[model samples]
Target: MKLIEALPIVLSCQNLSKSFRGRHKQETVVLADINLEIRKGSFVTILGQSGGGKSTLLKLLGGFLPPSSGNVLFNGQSLKNNTPDIGMIFQDHNLYPWMTVEQNVGFGFRIKGEKPGNYKHLVHEILDTVGLSHARKLYPHQLSGGMRQRVAIARSIVVKPTVLLLDEPFSALDVQLRRRLQEFLLALWSEMNTTMILVTHNVEEAILLGQKLVVVGSNPGRIVEEMTISDIQYRDRYHPDFLHVQRYLESVLEGNLKEQGDNYYEEVLAISRIQKINS
Candidate 1:
């Protein structure tokens, strides 16, 4: 295994920001000055509340949306536009209803104008890698939520993009299924060595998957805290250090409950004002 520090930065974001037009015709900022670097083959996870700008950041990195300020760099070039070097998987399966699992997995290659025969072996290999070999002929509707997600993952990774962006990919699965898929993804990452950025609301999931965990908040969504999980003892989620970090993050989000007297109203009003303006 290559030392983490020796891995080159595969993606970078500098002073990234985004805003939406408010109902009052003012700009409601969702993110501001977001700077991040994803090392080659590293897994970075962004975790936040439901309304936080996690999804927006993911979209920006994936080239699905333009940043209001700053730039995203892929390799050494500015990501001023979309490119095939990035691939994304959303919460939705997003497979063509008419296409079989094999076809969907090969869709990226097909769109690139590659002949089926050229990518046929690769597609089969990825399907098996994702443990979906038995259901290669199934369609989206014919599969369970977990299975569909596996197909989506297969599709994204089949192209072997330099970076993979995922937005809550296993959010719809049951607890057991989600855990299973998480293990599968970690194993797959070990084998393929792909750089990945995942946006999720699941704290445990973030802790388990990320080499670094970024906590984001809404209303000019900026990173509030970044925790390195490299030393986390994953085998014992209940370990003292693990619990301590979890509690720290939870407190960061909920604020110090004991000090909610005079400052509570101000914080409440700040949130309310943003919502009223955005609404």
Candidate 2:
């Protein structure tokens, strides 16, 4: 096996299942039988339709939510709760509005009661890497949407976590900005080499970022498909292979929507047919 393939598993989940209790003691199964293994320094992307439990699965993996059954393993040990070794970035950027960019990025150290002198250099290095050094004095409200998200990413990585979970961090941005941030994130991942898992509904984004792509089916979410992506062609959005993979994943997502009895599925199919014909 190749050296990268021989890398140690940083995170894995075995027979993982999660359910929520609703009104009248009813149960809603959000995820089921999720078994996954993520190698160190690898990037994995979970792609599914909205409300398909992609985010829920991410939370379970990060120990932000408890699994109703099975276990999430971190380095072969069962993870019972959130750990500093695991970091998370959400869609909202979740920065302290009152704190400046530098303060927010270094807040992890402050909360742990560490002296600034101990972590100041680390904070500055990460800030400069993310190209946010100039905005270090700016508050969350003072930065643009993409800039704010970068700050959140910087904060999560400043502590040098072994794993990072991103819950659609760029979903809120416009197309151009989202693409820019995606490239920035890819570069950052290359530099930091953190084991990263991102959950998103966007097929293109998933294909663009992940070393492996996992598709979750809805209505009691389960892992329907997993693809190991290594070809450089998959990274180029305009490439034929990339478009082919994108279309296939879209069909998988549409099938899930159809299974849910979603009425918009037919409309989407019709639109897709029209677009193909026009092209």
C-alpha-based local distance difference test score of model 2: 0.85
What lDDT score goes with residue 213 in model 2? 82
Q: Model 1 segments beyond 4 Å from truth?
A: 1-3, 22-25, 257-279
Candidate 2 structure quality by residue, lDDT tens digits, 137-198: 99988998889999999999999899999999998899998988899888888887688899
How high a TM-score does candidate 1 get? 0.88
lDDT of 2 at 72: 97
User: Which digits, one per residue and each the tens of the lDDT, describe model 1 over residues 97-151?
Assistant: 9999999999999999999999999999999888899999988899988889999
Clashing pairs in 1: 30-221
Q: Residue 174, candidate 2: how far off, in angstroms?
A: 1.8
User: Any idea what lDDT model 1 has?
Assistant: 0.81
Q: What is the lDDT of residue 271 in candidate 2?
A: 40
**TM-score per candidate:** 0.88, 0.88
Query: What C-alpha lDDT values do all the predictions have?
Result: 0.81, 0.85
Error of 1 at 118 (Å): 0.5
